[model samples]
Target: MNKPTLLFTAALLTAPALLALTACQPSGPVTNAPETNANSVTTLPISELPLHAEQATRLDNNLWLGVHPHGDIQIRDGQGALVGQQPVAAEFISQRRDAQGDFFLSLTTDNQLMFYRASAQGISDLHLSAELPWPLEGMCLYQPSAQELNLFVMDESAIAHQLLLTRTQGELLAREIRQFPLPPLAEYCVVDDSTDQLFVSEENIGVWSYNARAESEVLRKPVDLVKPWGALEHNTGPLAISQGQLLVAELGSDLLHAYPLDGGDTRTWQLAPIAAGQPLAADALTVSADSDKTVMAVLDDNNGKVYRAELTLPARAGDNQRIVQVAPVAETRPMRKSGDAADDPAIWVNQQQPELSRIIGTNKKYGLYVYDLAGNELQELVVGRVNNVDVRQGFSLKGQAADIAAASQRDRKAIALFSIDPLNGQVSTAGEVVTTLDNVYGLCMYRNITDNRFFVFINDQDGRFEQYEITDSSAGWRGKKVREFAVKSQPEGCAADDRQQRLFIGEEDVAVWTLSADAGAPTDMTQVAAVSDVLVADIEGMDIYRSDTEAYLVVSSQGNDSYVLYQAEAPYEYVGRFRVGINAEKGIDGASETDGLTVTSQALGADYPAGMLVVQDGRNLLPDENQNFKTISWDSIRAVVIAP
Candidate 1:
């Protein structure tokens, strides 16, 4: 296949004009002045925030929280008022504050450490601390001695999947001071100075603690926090130490559990529900002491709002603590085609009737195939390259009131809309080619239910997106030019959350982008979560799945043979990453690569049925070697979740 030359030609022809347009715009209008006062009690309406909030910590009296929605760190007072916000830098995905009142942020993007000291003047203290040898996820301040301000960071070293504790005391830095390798899929970790303990939370398997000063010590035996609760749900959340007791935030039940370190007593408190209509997906939390009151800072992920609640610890009796759902503000599916060999998938579903899904997938050397939800390969369409496909239903022209419905069905029957022989996988061109798409790697389908029209979005490797509208069709299907948008990097895989009017685009080395629908452009983009060092090669496919208020964005790492799953935090939250283990049959151990990924509710029905993740195994083919695709069921995935 020829590398898309048409897109390069279009860029060459339009570069100068675009440069001139950019040059004409003013750039000095923005300044670094503090936008809001430290005590400013500004309340960001819920509509402007993220969908879920994860990872909440107390930075002295002022609480700092991280949200997955937009990957922003928000600062609030003890009274729970939005004081300031800062978009996390590209290098970091997680952050924690130290005892010296310095925010220790984990720069997972670049495998470095950042220190942001928040003063009364807001985020005026930002410093680039020491860089780590490997990427890290969880971080906390380890104050072993009062005179030293040492930071402990957790590194995801694949060798043993251990947490490399890097201690830094000014110029004296020790890399890999201590290593704690736990079972795979470890959730949250915290260094408790009060008890001199390090608590690590594992999924299904409860909490484990070890001496902070020990080099390689076994945890204080294991505690099975979750019992055999059948196949309904799983437990995952953050762990912290409060008043010599270990506090575990159960995300599955939205409950904060308090277990005594001395094995004295156990108490569970239900967090207050957020305000009416507000979604509550708590990621991480921290409890703060205020002379007379015990306050807790919770990341309200639903709307990307941070909330502070008053905590009343039990004095002597077995009474439970009360938690009130406080107010927080926050931010912020498929189709296919036909081909015997489904290469790429493009989905089209009516906005009003999303259940009526239509998919267009490529057959590579053969042609395209159309399919319904029932796995019935309907028809096949043909096109050049046929590397990717996109479908749009009920498209309208600027001046045409044509019968598109009758035309769509008729075209399917005549095999004239595009061209494909379902039996033999051959292309018979009937429709004329529109604008040539350059290195088209990703595709999306957008349908306007109000107007009953649709637009097809194609991501070209030349850093541009082409949009085409299905036009008036009497003989078959005809496409018309709609619009085009510029991107910074080559787009790999993309998924659109039409219900939320947002599009998630995965680029090469860059972090994902969340674009708005009204402007048909990106409003905010941040580099938060990435797939280890493998992302440097490229990110391939992405899919968006939403269940009521919760949303998930799964991205495929074409270079690493893994998949990175992100939970939409207050605007979105970066749930921890889950890597699919390659099996012997898949030949992942060989030089084979894992490419495209599609997640649906289909797998939730069999054993897992909560939801299923389907990955494409790209096996290496020698000059005479041939291989077929292998599927990993959700049951196998759940094993990875529990596999140490």
Candidate 2:
């Protein structure tokens, strides 16, 4: 790898730039990235990339090569003289011949997929298609048949597999994504056009194959292809197919093994170095047919080297292709309204039956709307202007251990409390706690396991927040104000990390301030990401997603129509940020003006098996519809979190 270089290179801030949402603006110190706001992002001019051939291939009478990640992609003529070069940024690029015998390659720069077409005229830009949510490994283009070509990109984490429909395409389509499942992370993959199969090499596991088309089974299991080859614990290189044999590059051992799909014994070769005195440190591999000869190529990351050799063929391995990667999806709450109303959500996980879990959303128009993980509205409560909501399970409510939910009611200027039915996934109003603050807005739950008590922290539009404790009374549920906080401007989004005893509050036009979640605890606050820099004005919603080993804070940059993620604990390091871009598959629009968001790290159902992230969409339109809550799979967010 080209050692981690300048990341998030530039930082520019202006007053007018702060006024608009940074939906598409470059938000980081990206090296050489242009200053952008609300209009463009993920930019890299072809003239900026410097070319140094890390790998090279001879195809269509030309030499195609990829430079360093931040360097250029170059095309040279048959005489090995540079014909032309494109300052294209990419960590790696690989080429394959199309059915028409022309070559095409995928160049990945910062996880954004770029394509180049190689023909008799030389190499030309194809499309800078899919915006990968995270840095991933390997990519392939499949032509199940002529007139129907698709792009497949692998997620480096065990989160998801994506297919751009195309995230950006030619005269065919643009930015359509379909997501599917595969091994957590795939290091190498190749498409067998003859059998219409896609094979993904799962290091230490084995070679796995799947059908290239939709509706076909994907990543069922690994084919027992590597047991005879020996343990491939550090198989970080590539895999290729020529004729009936499969060529596997063992990077760790500096060896190459060819396995015949038939019953023949596997052949092994000690790979020759790209240069004298150097051993092969393969990063990628490719196999091609030159007339009756089989040619293979290897890319070395450590040495910036390229080597190619010819190989012998083996008999066909039968018709054994399975299925694999599709694009991602965007979903929203099923209920519709005449105007923007939906504000926040709270997820209740039914540990016994994952599918029975419910997503409780506050429809500011009237009350709390509950939906299944699939976005189907299950129930709605006319509780009067519920704005932001949150839930915490395993609470000792009235001496009974159950789940409790609360919301800030704007109309009543109170906190509406509900009892969650863990069994049937139903919710009913337990009671209400009228607050002293005017114009209630945001609310979150905190359960003190030490005292076995539950608390509700509610904030208002006037920048005042009160922490109240819910106690069981002989009459009904009553709340007592435990502590109070005040900020300089409007305050809305707030979340309490019961696990860490910390609370994060978003001061609309200011920044996120943190303090103790305990009653009577000192309010020594710390600023997280402030306005105009890490965040634009009106930092909206905040929630904490607790994974197995760590926790992450998810924030809605309402002013910019984007969501920012953080490490959640002290010294909250920024992970990354992403706007809920359009989901062409569902005809659903991305989110903007998000007021509140909530997350649950539990598999609610098959759709959200890893978990679900629910955010309120300020502008839920395209056909111009009213606002509602959009649900993004937490797995999608996890991909970015796990990315380098």
Candidate 3:
């Protein structure tokens, strides 16, 4: 309940300092200043096409496909000669082509999206390969790799959706991964794949740019604006990225503006006149870039005429952020409650049959959930409002050897305990021990390899932490406060390396710290990692993955929906970052906005021979159900991100 206040305080206290530094940087405004070689472009008139197409996309240097207003497509050569036609039977409001020359068109009526293959043979080869449902005003495609295709779409209400499409088993699977707000009256959008940036035009406002990656933050930077705001003469129109520049068309000015992707002076070009000194009212535009030359096509919507011109493009280096993508193998059934109810997850390995291990997760709003390895809900313990949970094995409970799981119960401000039956994999509540903290938040358990003693560490929302040693008694399980400490800010996640006697604690907006796990040891701490580009702010859950040879530390970079890894030893060398993507074949959506994750290196089965990773999915999509947890095999991640 106090989470909102903590977040607000962090932002309020940090905004001034952040803004002060931003103010000192030069304002790289989008200006009307032309490039050094302003008048070196040649303009020529192409033929007037016979078809009154609303929009057109150039397939190559010589082929163009025009979308007609009457629900048909006309294929024409560069000379305006019609080659073939196809009746699409749907009124498409927007169209875009990917790097592979495939076309994606969207219709507003049924909220339908259609896909077609591009072919140089003729329109006969333009067969519908796939279709999905989405409501949008305009859309553009971004291809990060040959196996991944991203679609950025804008709706009439000015909402943008980033959909990830993956090809699997001869089918294209789509998942809506992220959504954010946009200015009203926005119509056109384009993505610069090289930079992973999206540019949108807010009809009467201006052109703005946004980070296009699904894992990036939702922020808008001004590219250009209308008259008084920037250098553009009219409202923004069509948008395209070609030859290291963002080409923006002015709605009614018959002028084209080019802004370098890397901040530079803007260049303006006047389209060839349609008649004797009459400017063409450009509406739609497209550009084709190749090694030989760059071709530009502009459509005069008023007269239904298409004009073509050629220009030279300046050379610039490409800058791209590389993010590794891995798919989830399975996902648990969604929780009964909705809206951020799922917060943390823990894995309980079954000694009898490793394949039968269970994944324990906290509903936070309801209770604890137990799931089988196949992601089926095995049991639901309706304990009230448990925020975080962890498990430790070989604990003596009620005169029997059992696995113990501990969670911070916010409703009672206490530690909730459960005993897992190792043989049958059954979890039963043991007891709850009350704490003095105002609000109990994060919890983790540790077992001493030296003395075989079990203890649990719990932190309050105000940064106070307490360590308790679990003791078995005639009454039941109880905890004695052994040691206490505090961080400068709120800390939610703490993982103990029992073997190294080291404990890792995450201070939400600051950094990850380490200290001795020994009760009598000094409270001195060392900085493991700080919040940076790799480890985004609001660092949430973290756990250690121990292989036979080494141990790797995985921390959730919650701000950007990515996970960062480090060597979990002295020096703590940084590994790589990766994101869980949609598994097209299994129909399981990716995990994002994660709050807690747990990893184990015990070989579970054939699917998880190297170990498994289970994470809480804050935003579960694929049918838009309640939140759930996803499972990813560590072997798959090692194959892509870990070097041999």
Report the number of the highest-lDDT candidate: 3
- Model 2 per-residue lDDT tens digits across residues 1-644: 01111112011224343223132332121112111232332211111112256555555453545455656666665445666666766654555455546545555565566666654465574666545665676777665433335566676664335353332444223243345555543667776665455667666544555654432323333333233232332453577777766566765545665555433555556665444665667677766666666766566667555656666554354543221111225455544555667778888888898877787888787788888767788887888888888888776456666578998878888999998876776888998899999788888889887877889999877888899998875565789999998888888889988888899999988888889999978988998778864476778888998868768888887655567888898898877776565555565555667777888777777777677788876655444455677787777666644452
Tens-digit lDDT string for candidate 3 (1-644): 11111010111214454344234422233334333234743354554554446666666546777675555666777676777666664433233455545554534233445555434666532323254454567888876444457788787767788787655454445578667877777778888776667888877656777777664556666676565545667668988888778888888657787888776667777777778878788777777775655676678867867667676778656543566778889999999997778899999999879999999999999999999988999999999999999999988787778889999999999999999998877999999988889999998988897888999999998999999999887777999999999999899988988888888999999999989988888889889999997898889999989877979889998887888888899788888888887775576777777899999999999889999999888767675678899999999889777962
Q: Looking at candidate 3, what is the lDDT of residue 611?
A: 93
Q: Give the TM-score of each candidate.
A: 0.37, 0.53, 0.84
* Residue 74 lDDT, candidate 1, scale 0-100: 62
lDDT of 2 at 12: 27
Ranking by TM-score: 3, 2, 1
Global CA lDDT computed for model 1: 0.45
Total backbone clashes of candidate 2, pairs 3 or more residues apart or in separate chains: 25
Looking at candidate 2, the ten consecutive residues that score lowest on lDDT are 1-10
lDDT of each model, Cα atoms only?
0.45, 0.65, 0.77
Better of 1 and 3 by lDDT: 3
Once model 3 is optimally superposed onto the true structure by TM-score, how far is the C-alpha of residue 39 displaced, in angstroms? 10
The true-versus-predicted C-alpha distance at residue 459 of model 3, in Å, is: 1.2
RMSD of 3: 5.5
lDDT of 3 at 273: 79
